[model samples]
Target: MKRLILHITVIAITFVSLGTYSQNNAFKGYTIEGDSVVFTFDVRDYSKFTQEYTGQVLDFTDFEIENVVVSGEFNLWSRDHWKMNRVNEHLYQLKKSLQDFDDEFSYEFKFVINNAYWAEPSKEDPNITKAAKNGRKIRDVYNLKMYTAFPKKDGNVHFKLKGYHDARKVVLAGSFNKWHESLFKMKKTKEGWELTLQMKPNIYQYRFIVDGHWMEDPHNTNKTPNEYGEYNSVVDIKEYTAFKLRGYTNAEKVILAGSFNNWNEHEFVMRKMDYGWKYVVPLSGGKHHYKFIVDGEWIVDPNNEVKEYDGNGHINSVCMVK
Candidate 1:
């Protein structure tokens, strides 16, 4: 009996580990795993560390760092707080949840050395941007960027405008940046003008400013009328979200039905796993009501706590794609 119990515990542990790995995605500098974000800092990237607390300077080759902490707007720029986990002699890591940050914005941060020095990144780094305080920019202080992981995507989104090759300047503006006129400058390409952004999945309305003239995307037909009587082109970014129904391993089959697909019962057949059943579907941004049909019986998601009354005397699970 003891041996059998041990075997059961091992199987449970294996399924839990597999579930975790399937949900998390890691990239350079940071990783977005479900609602958690992990940030990595490598001391090898810095040439020198200037200690403000002790007025000491240490070179990368000859010095020792006793501790490392992360300071940024998230912690109100408090140095010596938020210590990182030391992975090796040269690497450090920190993890935080998506609840700790505001959605859809980039946070400026820097690594601290031994609770004293501020580690600065090279200005040429793409993720390095200037620091600001009280509405004024702090010149010469460069910081690293951390973004909220919602509306997640694995890659960059490309925006292009054709037939404007002769234009002097082109800018990409929309709800992403509150329609800032000159923030997102598009480069002139052989075909036209183009710009790429690391945007999260959501519906965004955008327009092109060609030589100071605001115009919608001519190549795209998905547009809506604006308050100015003109039209704005729309783009709906979507990401694959996995839904899993745990337990009920004896069930013959499971089907995934959601409002995104008009709640068709037979459309999405879930793949059976050791722990349960799983299905991955690309869904657009916003709230979606879904349920699982198990062996021809309708049921709400067992693991999800967010559910709503459909007003038809039935409760349905809700998934919000931010």
Candidate 2:
């Protein structure tokens, strides 16, 4: 009788240990640390997918989940880029860093299990799911909203478009508003049309749609070509780096050309001040090579001490930003 009781106790202990192991291997949700976002998945939840469709008890214990990967818009929806790591017996995780990403960009991602099964978030809970759908083969069906980084500041910058007197309607479109043409309408002013947008310290590409005619900002010379081969006015709504070139006061036109603006000769025209020609441009935190275009002659910054060869036999002024 004592041996019979000992056998029963051993069987109970085995079941309890299995139950605890299964519970420990369950998904514990995602984690966010600074610019990194971590996604976690549990292989045990794979049965949920079969149960949802067949309405029957499906055991996934025998099914082998070999690999898991993350595919998303940030990586251009590449299937083989971000492979998840198996943390425990059933738990898998993938951590992605968005430190180099823009201030605010929307992205969508889904997990691929065994390189064949595509798992997505369930409607009930976004953090935990075992739902796999075939419709997700179409990349546009992604429904996850992920933010890369937070904005630095909440400040309103005034954007003005001048000399469009005959325009009946004007709209401001750019990266901030997802380049929506008719989203932010500009108010008509005596000088032209103006709009105040709450913006953070970042570089933005924008254009004015005056009476349905897309045009670059006439007053702002900073412009860049968009994906459509059309020019869009670029604005840096942040702290300015005063690029001054002394002894260029007598020049007809002084332009600020730099790696920041893709070496565009006519993009940034400098103002002829009393001492020299000055151009205040919003430069992000990095090192940049620049030159001054004084009457079509490229010249390095006279005031700047740091200089580097531009691989084209010409020395360029190097500006370092903290």
Candidate 3:
């Protein structure tokens, strides 16, 4: 059941032609510094008719644009099926007719401004706990990747993300070109804060707000993952190792007597295939993270491939483990 094309009058005519959105169409804009960028996005809420269908079809050519500086290839014309994604991260590829194909769905492209989030959902915490709720008045957490039209040459793509206790600065937005975030910040070395971005590969999702919370990329590579089970905010500048593989079912095989290798059938004895229990873990290719544990009592991961969040938080599932 995978066929849900998008086309709602090319997203209400580009929101009446980007009238009131800043940053060159900023619903949270981004365009990192030229060399290529003419992409557009809008999928007017999508549609569907009944009674033997009415009239509306979609197949937006082959939408593709990539991460890690310089990668873009575009083609979407079911009357311009609303476009974006034409990647080329320095020959890593995505433009050549959209690197063949491997399909997935849930494509909406109208942005009212949602830089998606997930900063510090617990990278183990240790002693660093951000996320608040006392009086509640803090927003702006968007750290995305794909920079380096020579951010310092040599395939650069580094970062630091120091720990802030009271904070005043720390911003990095996503989608490569929307939500530009002060032309790039995050440098404070001596082995604590570094910043680099020279990309052109593919795969990106981002988050990070610091003072007010919202974070990810404890390393990088944990692409989209959201729904009810959260964690879907990414960043993949490319070394690859972002784990986001989930699929479960009625899994419960325990015995718990004296504790065998079974350890009470932990992780449901590992499944991942028979069309249900599957969970892979590893993230660094570009970082973002979220999940759900169930029986043990950690929840989220309702199958959200990245709608965008960090504001209305909760409901996570995202990975980065090649």
Candidate 4:
């Protein structure tokens, strides 16, 4: 009788294990490189320590990728969707010529995916009248916030970003300052995480790493809208002006060069100005974004549009030279 009981217990345990495993989610990934986007399944953030995080590329060559959904964004919180592209078996290219934006303002890739009509992640929210209104369902680690005379300061570009393992101490890691935690160290508050990146003035691109999970901001302000459905945020940094722009840079041009930008050393180019070197490129003349590319360096402009993307695939910015 005891043997029979043991066998039943073992079978029950196995079934439970399998059930738990099946409940997990399978996510595919893609990268936002300049004006192009690439499909990949092997992007992993294996950060061993808090101060510094690590990343590795997983093997996705043999993986069966079907019914794939790929999207990109600039910011994570609000609804700012500057760069919106779909992923194909090979890769989906953004047809729009953002070289002007890249040349002047900066752009970054933000992403979110649906498990293909998968169930179980949904819950009941009485206040949420429309069930489909809930767009972002996944939770992540850290988020980004800007301070000072920058535009979009009115909850326009919110980023419910990924975390640093357990938030033991979360910092915004990026190439703007050697991907160091000290510079972009975020402040935690009851509302959420916050930080201020005093970039010089130039177009910049970056991503968020939470506890090794590579994800875009959940609360992205500039989330782009889509035809089929859903949205993606593309972060954009504007140009800098003396009164509006704070910080200092004494050089001809400041282009962006970092790990994300292949560290080309001469990637972005910042134009010069009278008081300081500025990326004085021609924008539409409305409220536009322009970053300084002084002496081969990239910095976020302290002043510009602070708009988020609508969930329908559009673009907007508020932190650049107008």
Candidate 5:
């Protein structure tokens, strides 16, 4: 009888060991190999992809993850364009093909998990690196993780100025090419004046000089005011994050105040649109806290629900800078 009981106990222990091994061997749903970053979502490990609130795990399955996307500086940080594919039962995958931009390229990226939460690299992840400012490791730029198929080529930017036909000459000046006034001279065209410049991928703040007067590009809607209270036409030749707010058309002015611009309320005034306000600002990867000042009233973003306490008895809207 004792031998029979011992045999039953041994059998139970063997089954338990096999069950634990099976659970542990499940696919983790993500892998970074060579120049490619791959994500494999497996339903068996669904609990592992969830966010932890306090001590409880907030399972993402409850929200019914409709989609997943990977975005970063490489794609100009578009919010919802790169969608992943579901391969099979409880399995989804996204394989990002990288390009080589010549130099030691580094870029920050994030996973738009379930089209709702912007998931950062796990703290325990071996690839995660420490970042400056905040203790958050999400800002760490992945160095050459994704290699481009071809080398980066120079882009041609054509500058045009209208109604400047009467002027003797027009020069292009900005951060690009060292703001040289005499270097880029515009040729007169039937419509106005134009100049084509071959430049690398970058953001440039420029103005057209007609005769002796320096003026912003009237045709371009994007502009940034300088310290001297002058507006400079802004041009983005690379990827950048765009911010938008809606339902404040009646407000006299709406300004984008955030940690990126040192919380300068007047520096980044947003342009009014038919539905609301819009502005495109270049920001590095990581986390950013911001608020909108609509006609002097500081308010959190009505559209963005992600927020955190500002310690001053105010709630600031939070955003991931990927």
Candidate 6:
């Protein structure tokens, strides 16, 4: 009886361990980390395919991979633009920033082997999608699943509208989506409507469309006048941009000034770090020109490469916000 009880306890523990492993490692071919998206292609996840041009069946194993590249609409479907790094015998991976892609719900792409054959998902797979060109479907070409990633952490923005329970649809349209009327639909909640987006730091103007009627956000008082004799809601989604002046530890004071603040010399005092002086400030979209004032001596940013003339025959460092 003692031996039987010990055996039962071991089986229970084994099942629990297996269940936990299965839940955590359900491979999805991709992972999103904040602003970066990592695309992974595992040979074991796909099935055998026949090369249409060569009429040769390709069986992918750990030893069969020569090279792999990711082709998609973002790169005009080029066969060799974005190459993947081999992580192991069967895994090929590539990483890209969110800024590298245009604003879209999803994108279609496939992996290319040896820059010749396309690695496709099986028809039964949910990631499999038909490829099309010029509004016509292509034959014998299947793409992997639509892949996309959203920014997390500091990039998340939430918008809500209250007391529109009877409306059929509430859409959030703004400069982010080029003011498309139906692209971003809000979900109805117990309170009202809500939609969250991962957006870069910038100033944007938006309005809510409730059942085909457009109106500014009632709950938000910040607004700007539009040409149509109405007001549009405004939100400044900003990120902290850091400016540093290295090797200036002995300076009595350091100030940060730029085009964002009309070159005010008194604002944005820099703090001393271990290496040098630093200051972080929130900024909106577009280009800004700035310099560091160390001991009241004006100098351009030594670390930044991009610079431009300020029309007064003086050169200033430039920082672009996207």
- Considering every candidate listed, which one attains the maximal lDDT? 1
lDDT of 5 at 297: 93
Cα lDDT tens digits, model 5, 1-322, are: 0100001012111000000001111114344344444655455543434231222235555556677776555565555777778887677777753332222234445556665454434454322333323224233322112211111112134566766567998887776534556656777878777665433234458888888789887656667997779898776442256688999888999999998798898999898888899887755434678999999999998999999987677789997632
The candidate that wins on TM-score is 6
Q: Flag regions of model 4 displaced more than 4 Å.
A: 1-166, 181-183, 221-234, 240-322
Compared with the true structure, the alpha-carbon lDDT of candidate 3 equals 0.32
- Give per-model TM-scores: 0.59, 0.37, 0.18, 0.23, 0.33, 0.62
What lDDT score is found at residue 159 in candidate 1?
A: 68
* Per-residue lDDT of model 3, residues 1-322, tens digit only: 1111111111110101101111232221133223233322222211211111221232323323222121111221121232234343212211212122111111111121112111111222121222222122222211122222223322234444554534666655555534344444554444344454444433445555554455554544444664536453554333322222244455452111111112233443333445555433222333244544444555444565653344457433444321
Itemize residue pairs with steric clashes in candidate 1.
151-201
**Whole-model lDDT for model 5 versus the true structure?**
0.56
Better of 1 and 3 by TM-score: 1
Tell me the lDDT of candidate 6: 0.68
The alpha-carbon lDDT assigned to residue 75 of candidate 4 equals: 31
Worst 10 residues of 1 by lDDT: 1-10
Q: Candidate 4 residues 154-229, lDDT tens each?
A: 2112333333434644445443433333334445655445553322223333335444443344544444554436
When 1 and 5 are scored with lDDT, the better candidate is 1
What is the descending lDDT order? Answer: 1, 6, 2, 5, 3, 4
lDDT of 1: 0.69
Query: Cα lDDT for residue 13, model 6?
Result: 9
The 10 consecutive residues of candidate 6 with the worst lDDT sum are 12-21
| Better-scoring candidate (TM-score), 3 or 5 | 5
Evaluated at residue 120, the lDDT of candidate 3 is 15
Q: What local distance difference test score does each model get?
A: 0.69, 0.60, 0.32, 0.31, 0.56, 0.68
TM-score of 2: 0.37
Better-scoring candidate (TM-score), 2 or 4: 2
